[model samples]
Target: MISIPDEIGNLSGLITVELHLNDIEGSIPTRMKELMNLQQLDLRGNRLDCSISDEFCQLKNLGWLALSNNKIHGLVPTCLGNLTSLRYLDLGSNNLTSRLPSALWSLKDILELDLSSNALIGSIPPQIQNLRAITKLNPSRNKIAGNIPDRIGSLLSLQFLDLSLNFITGMIPKSMETLIDLRYLNVSHNKLRGEIPDGGLSKNLTGQSFMMNDALCGRNPSLQIQPCVNQISQQRSNLVEMHIAYTPRLNIMIDVTSGLEYLHEGYSSPIVHCDLKPSNVLLDEDMVAHVSDFGISKLLDSGQSKTKTKTLATIGYIAPEYDQKELCLQKEMFIALGLR
Candidate 1:
């Protein structure tokens, strides 16, 4: 069909058009947008290009729009933010580039939006928080970047969020652990670091899905992490050198406990690692803790700050106040303090 005759516009009460998969060619007739009452339009399997008409936004009652498998270019229209009545939109499989419109987040009634397989770049905007009503969003296969913003965890209504194959980075937000409704998430191939949350989409990822990012570590069986001990040891050594007081006690611990005490606690007597573990703390003849191991007494992270959390490596060695799943808990340090 070349499209309904212009005379059909006079009918004035049209709500739907079913013409689809008709092997149509060339640009979508601009006059088609004149059907103000048109609620649904299907122009799939076509050779459309440039971009969808901003005129489509005129269809306030329009609920579904499919412009996929086309040659659509340029950023999506900012006017889409005005489509408060739309429930579904597909602009995938195109040459779309740049960030999505900030206005599109206003589509509170939108249920599914697929802008996948495009050239979109830049960090996924946190302005997306306005999409409080979205259930599923697929922006996979884009050039988007930075860590998935923390606001994504606030999406209580999002059940599916696919941001795979992007350049997102930094550690995965600990807040994402609270997403109880997220059943599927694909943050693979990004620069996201740290462990994946225990439940939700992360729980299902094989190490393979989250592979290729050197910063990422997960409990998934598919991922195999190299020993991180060497890295931690190097950092610990740095802090030890900075620990000025320990430098004196390094060679001689005999009856040096009191001097070390003054050094670690300072003249004010601030308690360092008040919760020492069961292992015998490394102490000199005077009960002064050594700056190095065998006693595990020196604040391993011998930085200038005496009150910093003891860097531990054991799973539960961290302080009681910290949530293990969130934050960068130095469980290894916690364990070293306990073991000897």
Candidate 2:
């Protein structure tokens, strides 16, 4: 391995420096700022154990920068936001730490940004909504937490996004339901809960793209998730609210029962939703009530024939046999829906 010679920065009129795939080591010389006309700097696939130079931001004419597959560590310099002419950036496969600087979102001219495979922590700032010109963003394989920003859907030009293998929490933002241009998304292996939003860009992704988050539920059979309560509430809110006669109410009640039938008998294994109530019953776009809320549910395989321990259920809806033994699915659903 060889260390970059400091005197090499004397090339004042250098336009591009491609030293990738070498075994070069040591810090990137600070005098590199003298390359005022440099447009691209590719030092990837090296053993450089240097801090990413903050001085590189002074290369005002730079458009593409790739420093991946190095031993570079420490925080990404916020000064990078000053590279207004930059269009593509890749800093992946490094040992960089600390929260991503919100200032990086100010790169309005950037098209693709890759910061994956680092030790980055903290929440993705809402400032990302301002990157209206960006198309692809990959920040996977980090320690990021907090809810996904609601404004992510506002990036009309975004085509691909990957935030997998992080500590992200809370529901997938409802704002994401409007991402008309999103063709690819991966949010798996996080703490995200609630139902994956139906329709729009989300509908295009398969269950594999959203796996490992056990708290998540969805209406799509392909995802194998229990429908969420929030989806039901949204359906109810969209209704006309006219008073329905007894006959129409009966039909809604039957639909609710049929939903339970699928859970108890339609599947090879039976699923018992211990806490069934009106709030747990969600309606789809067609006003069909679907049983939901599997927070306290139990699964019964035909082979094991096991039952779950009793916890709490809604006051009026609790079954008599529930306190004595495992809940009986047929009786539990009837009592919960009958009173509603």
Candidate 3:
């Protein structure tokens, strides 16, 4: 592991510093900004720590700067927006902190920007609408919060987007449904709520891509998501042939039975879905029922038939045998559902 010597800055005319894939330690030399002719600075896969200095923004001639896979920390210098010639910039997989600077939207020549796996906070600035040249933007696995900017759809050139594992909230911008060129998208594991947008690239996305969010609902049967109320209401409004819907009603019943079977005998250990009400049954476009809201479900491990717990079923759905304490069982859940 070599410490980059400060004396190298005296060379003055250096154009590129490709010291990546090394065990280089310690902070970058402050005087390295003297490399007036430097165009690319690739120091990826290194052990370099310390904050990125403002001097880096002084490299007016720089075009490609890749400093990923390092321990580099602190706020990204706002002056980075001044690098008009920059085309590609990657600072991913680092320990960098602070909110992203809105000034970044000014980099009209930038084609790709990756700042994922950092400790960045705050919402994506609305000024992102100006990044017309950006084709790929990854800010996933960060601490970013608030709604995804509604103007994100303005980036017509966007192809790849990953905003997973953040604290982002609110509905996905409706404008995103207009991104015809988008090929990949992942916004899972966040606090996003509302119906998943349909049409365009959204139809191509699957259940796995939007899992772990408790409130997200969609219409795609392949995605196995429960249809949102708006979608269900729309379907009902358009159901001119109500007499032909008997088959769909039977399908819902069969799906509920299948769900109960899974809970009773599917896993390595048996589970009892204690609460089985109409409200707890989610439906897809095909009217297939999906068991949901397992807030009070119980597990019966090996040698254990049933464990007693406080009664938690909805009124009128509760079995007479269930008193102050109840032993949640599959048969009881079925009986409760049958009564309703």
All candidates: TM-score = 0.62, 0.66, 0.69
Per-model tally of clashing residue pairs: 18, 1, 0
Off by over 4 Å in 3: 233-340
RMSD of each: 15.4, 17.1, 18.5
Relative to the true structure, how large is the alpha-carbon lDDT of every model? 0.65, 0.83, 0.85
Tens-digit per-residue lDDT, 8-51, candidate 2: 78898889899999888887999888889999999999999978
Ranking by lDDT: 3, 2, 1
- Candidate 3 residues 1-340, lDDT tens each? 5889999789788888899999899999999899999998999999999788999999999999999999999999889999998989999999988788877889987999999999998889888987888999999999999998999989899999999999999988889988999988998899988877777857777777777778888877777777898889888877834634555666777888888898787887888877777788876665667999887788888666677778567556665546555577667777766734
Question: How many residue-pair clashes does candidate 3 contain?
Answer: 0
lDDT of 1 by residue, 57-104 (tens): 777888888878777787777888787788888888889985767777
Best by lDDT: 3
Ten-residue segment with the worst summed lDDT in candidate 1?
A: 325-334
